[model samples]
Target: MTRTYRIAAIPGDGIGAEVVGAGQKVLQALAKLDGGFTLDITGFDWGSERYRRTGAFMPGEGTDVLRSFDAILFGAVGAPDLPDHLSLWGLRLQICQTLDQYANVRPARMLPGITSPLRNVEAGDLDWVIVRENSEGEYSGQGGRSHRGLGCEVATEVSIFTRVGIERIMRFAFELARSRPRKRLTVVTKSNAQRHGMVLWDEIASEIASEFPDVVWDRMLVDAMTVRMTMDPGSLDVIVATNLHADILSDLAAALSGSIGLAPTANLNPERSAPSMFEPIHGSAFDITGKGTANPIATFWSAAMMLEHLGETAAAERLMRAIERVTADAENHSPDLGGSATTEEITSATIRAIGLNAT
Candidate 1:
């Protein structure tokens, strides 16, 4: 009675293929080691290269094709020659919005061997899981440009905030906060300026906070929140923000921890009606495309998150322990982490580390 989990792997563009390959290899090793379950992974050649060939990143049937899988392991998106918005909308956003994968979860922490850019921060000083409202908010894709090339051309990209969307994500964030040891959550908003939607976010957060008296929570302006993230990293536990703000903050969190190469994100539906997509937040770096210097840690971490989402908690923990083992050695650091190890080199080390564990 071995459990078989179907996974969709999308190595979107540039170094995407390299890191995704690394993740698949390590995951294969884990599957072989565990022997209790199986990963039936399907790889899709849908990305910038495909866009260049067909004017679309994925086909019309791509979303429906992915519905049967248990989870998705995404590499990266963005291409040197293709427009970022096109690549984003065509593939990633299409899958997310279509499937209602509305909760974007990004966890950042200082791994053992990595040195933080923050002056005195260490491992425990910066551990934060940012829960972003994924489906709507600034990224709701609601506006358009009226005049293409006119000097007085008008354009508007609307930010949508529904009470339904806000409440669900806030409740999700509070539950996540309750699960963490600190039992603290910060609701990020720009209510003072954007009084309408953002104010609703504040009201809903307060309403949600009342439901969880055991959980300590507060609201912060997005601007001041950024300063707090840097200056007082330890004080924060779990953070919940709108789409655009969390997008910016998570990148900064990655840099402060060590590198964007170490950041992983999970776009979840939470209801489990649709397959969740897990990916590294780092965009494609064409400069490192063929050089093998792309760090695979983020992809590996993303794979670990996917494993956890699939109820393979044991295997997921095993994968993360292996990652920490590799990151604990500076000699295993990729170029992004200021060492010269190639992607394959680091992957090999991670696989070997995975083999060392008894479980």
Candidate 2:
């Protein structure tokens, strides 16, 4: 029997729509080439524009609607006019936190054709996967303001860390490290200053370290981790950090690898209790919203992650190979990578490569 996977596509805002359009074409090409499975993608017009129209990014039943799909392919989020937090909390966070997608996985590496900013880094040297605690931490939304317009105004933003939350994420990070060839994991924390929650993060990570004896693990303060990431890129393999730290570090990782436009994110629920989400790490670039010059490789890479999450391993690897093949050629590069090719040209090249490609 042929396998059919239901996919939800949320082309959230700005270049999100552009890259998502590219993602759909690449996915269609991949399914056609694989011949073993097919995709049924449902597109939703839920984004900043929709928020402007109805005062909400999506319908009240949005989470209910997403539950039926096997996986979600998300485009970028945010807009020039909307408050960043509102756009984030309104859509992306709503889906992620609601579905309990507690593990945010981001992979950063030197693509074959791209040149790294690091002086002497090679493909294998700078390759790393960053696992972030997705559900809670600084972003748990536990704080509020006290005064309205008084001089003694008080505002507090709380970071919540529970034993259950810390333990699960640490275990997930360790298992991910064990799967990689190097079997090395770097746990990031700010335990020295933020003694409460960050300390809990450290304790749980150490406790989980005992469970994966084969994996070589170490800890780095969030500040020092940045230096280590740039100065000693090769020394790190898999990194685990809190939501805030990982968010910053991953952006730096993307820049070191090549371009921020090349990074992909997987918001995963390992237990498979709900559909996971895959998206590019790049945000909505309002400057290039309709320019047709945005890079589609990140979206393509996210699509590959979506396929892998859906158990279409062969298709996932094939899609990645095709992405690497196209990215390796600078002539087909988008403006972000310092080439002039349009989104259509690069996407077309990727789809063509998929047909001509083999495992």
Candidate 3:
């Protein structure tokens, strides 16, 4: 029996459409190569443009519509005219929170033919997977504006941390660390400054560390963690942090690895009760919207993660190797990686690489 997976692709805005189109091409190629399984993809037009036209990012029943799919392959979401918060919360956060996608996983590493900003860093030296608390903490949308449109206006965006949210993400990070060869995990937080929420994070992480004794764990203030990420890239393996903190650090990690264009993120529903969402960490590059130069490697890698989440590990591994192979060759590189190939060119090169490797 041939297995089929239904995927909801949301190419939110700007270059998102281009990069996601590239990812879908690679996925279709993979399906052809692996005849045992097939992918049924449906794209959703839900982002800034949709908001501007319909006053809604997605249809009113968007959640229900998405629930039927096995997984979601997402692209960057944002537009210059739309407020960042409005665009973000309207689509991405709404889906993640509503679906209980609590574990946000981001992998940052040096690609084959890319140069890291850090000198002497090579292929494996800066490889690290950051596990973020996705559903809650910092980005809970818990606060309000008391005196809006007034001279004395005050706005407060509260950070919320729950024991369950903290424990689950911590456990996920520890397990990930245990799976890696180093078996080391770095917990980043600002417990010293924000003593209340951050202290609880430390407490929960401390309690959970005992469960995975084999995984060596340590703590670092989020500030110091930045310096460590740059100075001692090899020392870190798996990292766990709050939603906002990890979100910031992962971008830094991406830039250090190569370019933000090459970083992929997985917003996972670990229990599999609902579909998880996969996307590149880079935002929709409005400046390069139709320039034919947006890098699609991140989206392709994101599809690879989506494949792994769907239990198509072999196909996922092949797709990743194909990406690495294409990236390894200067002729197939994109502008973001210091090469001049356009988006379609790189996409073709990647697909060709996958086909050649299969043979």
Q: Model 3, range 199-307, lDDT digits (tens) per residue? A: 9999999999999999999999999999999999989999999999999999999999999999999999999999999999889999989999999999999999999
Error of 1 at 336 (Å): 1.3
What is candidate 3's CA lDDT for residue 127? Answer: 91
The whole-model lDDT of each prediction reads: 0.92, 0.94, 0.93
lDDT sort, best first: 2, 3, 1
Clashing pairs in 1: none
Which 10 consecutive positions of candidate 1 have the poorest summed lDDT?
350-359
Query: How well does candidate 3 match the true structure in TM-score terms?
Result: 0.99
Q: Which candidate, 2 or 3, would have the higher lDDT against the true structure?
A: 2
> What value does the lDDT take at residue 102 in candidate 3?
94
Clashes of each: 0, 0, 0
Candidate 3 runs further than 4 Å off: none
Point out where model 1 deviates above 4 Å: none
User: What's model 1's overall lDDT?
Assistant: 0.92
lDDT of 1 by residue, 97-174 (tens): 999999999999998799998998868989999999999999999999987899989999999999999999999999
TM-score between model 1 and native: 0.98
